[model samples]
Target: MLTSSTFSYAIGLILQSIAARRTITSNSIERGLVIRLATDRCYAWGLAAQVAGFLLAFYARETLPVYLVQAAACAAVGVAAVMGAVAFGWRVTRAEAAVLAVLTVALVLLAGAAEPSRVTAVPPATGWVLTALLASCLALAPAAWRARGAVPLAGLAGAAFAVLAVASRPLPALDVTALPLQPLAWLTLAAAAVGQILLAAALQRGSTTSAGSAMDAVTMVAASAAGLALVGDRIADGRTAWLVVGLILVVAGVLAMARVGTVVGEPIRHTDNDVADQPITQGNAR
Candidate 1:
């Protein structure tokens, strides 16, 4: 479910962040090698989570509704929050906690309201669109690298990640072993793979807050909207109403959380060599 995947990502990110901080500080060739290895591991695990989540929904589409699966995946955000708190040693405020509770309830209600059906299979154009979009995102990585501010890098990364998420959605139908190949499926995989890599690299360049927020809030949501619209996915009657409301609540909650700056998504261990570009004190971690 989304809850489990969310928990998985939160933990993965926290671990990745911790490792990045250490490797960045040590600056040893060995450390660099280790960091690359860690990145690969994280990428593999993340890919698995994404694929599993999507396939679960696809396979179950016959029995369960689309909204239910998507909403369940949305629950992963909550898991991310919990893991973020633990990893960063941050405490949740009463208001934030209340917002999360409401979000959870809203998602659950939306899922329960869904209608199940077997929609038409994906078409070829989907492959071209995904490929082009992903290619575009990768092209932007150079700019993100040249950019100085954390915000710009984060923004570019967000866009790239959004493209990645969009590409990842149609993956369940891919048949890698088939003839010349399913160009569409391959395109989707390429986009998702490149997008996640770029997104992860973007996170490596700045604070966890900027990184995670860009990845989760900005990129993921934007991509989801694009997929729903472009892929011809429709929202069920009541669920459509709740989707709008749920989106509003999610945005408000994110903004409220953002007001309290600093990377609250992962922990940092201090060492003599470590330089604080933005020193987020313990008091501000929340």
Candidate 2:
């Protein structure tokens, strides 16, 4: 499941990146942007791949530590780099290859250190924590649409994805009928919705590597921390050193990826009348 999800995420993101690039070049109108993101054949297929990845990750989390699961999921960045090359002729630099190598080693160690926890039910405080985090993202969103803010928007979307992942921790343990009444389940939907919107916006304004790497870094770290502190996820016995070293390597790789995004063959096109301060939806779409 983990390995498959890694590829699915990579493929989905790559396709979505292509879709985003196409729309930004020729599309106009505010609401039309969102519509195109959904209706564009490439984007829709990309979304389907993401949904498959989500399902795979959802079940994988049932047996692994959240840190391990999240890290493994974010490993898609390396995959995306290679796929981008195939799909868009993006070149991976020497530095990127090194980062991908380090990232792979880190994932191996993290996987080795993960221990399946018996704790399945989410703590009551989790929902409240998710609510607070969701509110925080909403507050940060306005600033994300400003000039040169695509990375920040990606970060916020990552935070939301983290929230939803954490919120999903207890879902499999719950009775099917109880989901509708469960506040966390509802919060999960809201977080997923918000994350997708912000992520789309981020893709609209940023390079795939920059936006995706940022989102993956934030999502893995935030979700891993929340899982450890709030939800009792555990490292394997006598493997604390492995977890620590693995996390350090993960951080190093993610930071490197964020610094250098896998850009497409051509530079992003800009029209003469383009807005400088914000996205078209914000300025002229009104």
lDDT, residue 175, candidate 2: 74
lDDT, candidate 2, 77-181, per-residue tens: 778887767765668888888889999999999989999864557667778988999999998787676636357888998999999888877676667899899
Each prediction's TM-score versus the true structure? 0.69, 0.87
Estimate candidate 2's alpha-carbon lDDT, on a 0 to 1 scale.
0.77
Best by lDDT: 2
Candidate 2 residue pairs that clash: none
* Cα error of candidate 2 at position 104, Å: 0.5
TM-score for candidate 1? 0.69
Question: In model 2, which runs have C-alpha deviations exceeding 4 angstroms?
Answer: 25-31, 263-286
Q: Residue 241's C-alpha lDDT in candidate 1?
A: 73
- Model 2 TM-score? 0.87
